[model samples]
Target: MNITKTDVLWNYAATFFKISSSVLLLPIILHKLPSEDVGIWSVFSSIAALVFLIDFGFNSSFSRNVTYVFSGVNSLLTNGHDTSAQSGGVNYSLLKGLLSSMRWFYSRVSLTLFLLLLTLGTFYISRLLNEYHGNKTNVYIAWGLFIAINTYNLYTLYYDALLEGKGLIRVSKQITILGHLAYLLVSTVAIYLGFGLIALVLAQLISIIIIRTISQRKFFNADIIYQLQNCEGDDKKDVLKAIYPNAVKYGITSLGGFMIQKSSIFIGSLYLSLSAIASFGITKQMMDITVSIANIAVATFLPQIANLRIGGNYDRIKAICIRGVVIANLIFITGAATIIFLGTPILHLIKSNTNLNQQVLLVVAFSSLIGLNSGISGAIISTKNHIPFVKPSILSGVATILLLIVFFKFTNLGLLGMAMAPGLIDLCYQGWKWPLVVIKELNIKFSDFKMVIMKTDKPA
Candidate 1:
């Protein structure tokens, strides 16, 4: 159950390369596009986030299943060598063959579902555009862009999952770096040619498609394809069925989470100015970047943790959970401090004329705080398969919407207050609820959880 330092470095490098490339492009995008165009882009992104909900958490669920199968195969080989003289026993071969077949069948079914959902989503978006935007050509263009980007994203997930299964994270990192470079090159060219926002979308899609194709060739190869094609029947059902619950949990959580995150923009468009939405959107993007980094610690550990649990290394799993929480907090505190002190300067760099309400800063700061705090508990809950807590997460979204209404209606606190309310609610929920869940449901000692916050261990 030992994790090499090289593994951690490879994982971090991958995440950092991806984040850096996107960060580098942000300024170019903002500088070239108008504020209104940025707002429109935000709306498009918000809609795409909703499409993620339809993913039904298949990405994570599939990764978990893939990891389990790979780990199980390794375990069988080890046992076979130890007990059966290095040649696998009949039962070992049977299990290996069964798992291989099962993975193939599940992969086909997953691909089918992915395509079906994408079609349904396109139809839904088309209908929504008709009712809301009313035949605007840009809406159609936006929808096309959405489909292309999401299709590439779907394939990227496939390649990424395969890499995780093979534990070829260094290769994954290289693919990510190449993809980002492609995106930047395409976007720069598109901007130079006056291609507008569509250029940005196309750049992203093309880059992802290229990376996915290359990575698939490099890692998955012919033997994997042969195994998948030959797979069939009840074995496949078992793996798919095992993953279904987690997928549904993540899918529903994504739906509610997306609604909460996007409700403010929706409300702003209806009741506030487009400029206000633009300002808020910019701030949200900053927060998202920070959250994504904080999330890396948790994400890097998930496959390993799942493998550990499958291997019955519960003590190691518990230690990992504690370390993850502590690392998340450290990231959160540092990020929050930077935002509190430097938020205005950062915004000024992006748009010199951009004047933000002080309240907006507070809201953003508070929300970032809540986000960081909740990240610890959320990671544990997801990795441990304690998915019932997702109901509370859904409620957090509902609370965000209701609070926005009340804050805007009854308080004269303006946009900042409206924004800050969601953060406050999230903080309270994590502070109050996470403890009970960890102690009562997870059965981890409260003292151990507390020690995680106070201790400073490097994350595995």
Candidate 2:
């Protein structure tokens, strides 16, 4: 499962298509939906992000463990992995247990999520709709579809972990590209046909179906199916127990992450006008795009890093980290620069009512630079099956929220306050601490980092 150059290119292509579809879809969305509808959509998007919180980090834990199983590790561990126990052969018994555990876990979780969204989510959306001046019927219709799609997507989420854990980067990314294409084409046609918000949700439903179906076929090819069928019995409970500790930690960290990145919109909706939320949402969306593109290098190598970790290949991991960090920074800088310089004019060109606030965008760009690198560093640390930054991440999110409350209560900063709060909090801790920890852990020197920046190539 060595990562090939083609794999790298497809990874980039996948991200490109995913982001570009969103970018290309924006003008259409802006034209079709009013600013109020756009603002509502932003809330919907933020709420949808709660799936990450609901997942409680099981996806990453599952994916990392899947990598371990495929890497020939004989047993699972609650904390740290056992590199020395490698058997140099695939453990189909372990794989089968994990697959069973994943299905059992997601089935229950997905049902719970569906119920949560239906009750708590509907209550929240009802509040938003009560103040709405648009057609509430359309929004309600869209909301139902949103719940259905998210629940279905979460149920089939393991396909992603399965593909990436197998180091099928190229295949996984190809599926993403196809999914995004389906979303783009369907949404465009549906919107043009006057479907409005329902169009967006319907398109997403179609895309998720395509992605999951393709991923199932690709990962469960005849050879794998046969192997799995013939494997000895395994204890799903044991596998889950081994995964629970780190999975819980990762869940807490994700909660912190959600608070830091998304709480702003939710809070802003209470304090600011709908137009303000729309502006901030658009800027945040662009920054998210930049971050995702920046993350390509590191994201592509995650399973490989996990495999190398089992083999005690620190030097190789260091090289990937250095190169990944460097590439990520470069992409973020370029993308942020593009958004800062041209984002507003482009909005105007699209005749978009929701304009990006340049001041907020600039601040967010700087903060995002810190955030993306910290994420890369965090990923590096997680390969060793530990998550020490859980406390720091959670603390940062808390501090950011408190500061946001203070700023909004007594200051005139408005959207700038929303942008500045998380940046300042993260800069104090997560922004710098994680990278330093990675450098120390990997024994990376300033000179080595600089050298990697100058000559970024795959390590031997």
Candidate 3:
């Protein structure tokens, strides 16, 4: 239940490393690889991202449940957390069962994803190869490595759940920094040596192995191993059942999120030129960085939030949430202002292919700020283990997509249309509703919020 400034800083470092590795690699990639090869690699990156959604919502579900078990909850529930029957100590048997179920689930899911990649993914790659004018042999080798990395990464994904669930934020962030550092170093050197696309995928594969290995060692030290080994007759099937409901909700929510956040790029490609899409994409990417940095404190304190929820410490929860939201907004506002004023000039200085549109950036910034607020409010509500926002999220996503189509066909807004579509749709519902939901659910008055914002009370 003890979160620290150090924990938050580590999380920020991890996020920076993870995001910057790709940013730093981009210039190298464009410089060394052919444009065709770079395009193909971009496709591979997209596919890798899509493949990761195969994890659905299980990671968060598993992590939350792990936190619950670690927080002294004796049993798992299908829809809500088990706060009533407290064990007042970690439940090794429950942990063992949950771990068993996680392994059983991920093993099957990863295998299924691999099969899908081998078959359907290969078919799609073949179509791309028809148009590809690169070194075919190297591309094939890269594709093989890409599939292996993704499949193996998915298989070992439970390591993430275990680490974050145990509130090992510092160690988890350390592992992230190390893994991404390996990725950046290996890929940079190999590309400079003319390894081409293979270098990138190979770097990623090594990074994943390093991360999973360290995570395994960190989470399963001698004491934990001994405790799990001594546990017996745990019902993994029951554990899976208990996790299934919320996990599926989380997975669907993820899909909706992808649709809301990413559909613009796909839809924009149809109506706008590549240059326009690229500009919009750059602006969106900057906004994404803003969002990630803004969420650092909230993400770092999530396990503690869940722990507080289990203890029924509503006041402390309110204080923590209020602080998290306040910090998030302050960060976002600063980031957005900097991007608005400085983003395009920097892109111009780099002699980039495209520039960020300040108008688009400003609109997306507003939308993203709203999204961040709603997201934090939703996260607070989720600590009770009830996913009330799923339907609204999905509906908002659908509405955004539909509105984008209308904008593309019925108006000449182009990239501006793309930025405004999600923002306008969100502003109508999710932007305001979720925060209101949190206020009502937590029964927070203006005075209480003011007190928390003024730092009159500290969250445990």
Candidate 4:
């Protein structure tokens, strides 16, 4: 098969593997671990995502610029280049510089994250451990391992940036599936053997190692290696200087998004019981799978979108955007219904200690719909290479977190508060605001949106 078709199939296949693994693992963990421990694990997982906030969007910004270099561009810009600027062969010097810069930046950030995780992260976990029934020492040991694994994983962000930038989505996804397979096998065995929370972290560490080793071997092939080595790279500082402005904007956007989507778990843990946190976490996780599924089309087409935008084909961009939105909404609707209808029964069948309430599930479902729609808009907007919604996006997330904090503090709404706060806040700003902004930017009319629903024009 050709590259695009290969990537599309592997992308869907990767998502299928992920959804399967997530569904399969829940039963083992929920049955093996106590409710409180499950909650603690869920909270830790949420907070660990905070490490991305430290990334400052450097990886993505760097990768996008990598695509430019590969497209024969000599210099980088905050936004993408014009179609007329497209020229000949890859600029090895720029590619070399970007790789060096990515490594240097990630090296420093990885160490900083390790320190923070060892110190502040450990302290946060300690607080959660106060009323827990599990062995404290085991959790601490797992925490140490987790910090080390994540630190090393963060250091290898360049591997992923390069692979995805080169549009090696099929290989990249295949590598990811292999790693997740290892994760499933190890975690399943560990949980079955009664390793508790430690098993999950251990499995993750194993998965990362497998993924990075394979990804590095694949991305840095003989030809790429010769090219990079032969080229005299520009100074890393120069490359960073060219990319930092947009990268920082992306970082702020990342932070704001985390605040909106994940801060609820962090704040909610303080007010609700650990069991409640676990329930909310599971429900949210299931919906997150739906969100991931919904995003497949846009994510798969990102590199193509970049090329199309640079070629000044706004019509194709519009067509792709409409189709992606439709697919995303349909995925979210179908996945949400299944989770709402079969979720509890499935848990019961597996003898899981935890359950998702229908009300919380409904709220979570609605939020996923909006979040997925907004995400589609954001991904489309990103292809333009300008991050116009950075401020507004961050503001929406910050507002959501603040509202969640207030809800937790003043009211006794408990777990429901955690699920509902972001939904309410996001709908007011990011949920609708981003799509509106996207439509305006694309010059898409309401009637155009309606008409495109049936148009079935594949992105050129």
Which one wins on TM-score? 2
Model 4, range 131-169, lDDT digits (tens) per residue?
988799988988888898889989997888888888889
RMSD versus native structure for model 3: 2.6
Report model 2's TM-score to 2 decimal places: 0.97
Tell me each candidate's TM-score: 0.79, 0.97, 0.91, 0.96
Per-residue CA lDDT of candidate 3, range 28-107, in tens? 66456665565566457557767767898889899999999988888999977876778678889999999999999999
TM-score, cand. 1:
0.79
Residue 133's C-alpha lDDT in candidate 4? 84
Candidate 1: tens digits of C-alpha lDDT, residues 10-114: 767766767676667667667776666566666666655655565567665555555555554322221111122222212333334434543454455446545
C-alpha lDDT of residue 186 in model 4: 93
Put down candidate 2 lDDT per residue, 293-320, tens digits, no spaces: 9999888998888888777778788888
| Model 3 residue pairs with clashes | none
The parts of candidate 4 lying over 4 Å away from their true place are 1-3, 82-85, 445-460
Stretches of candidate 1 exceeding 4 Å from the true structure: 1-3, 73-142, 222-235, 349-355, 408-414, 428-431, 439-460
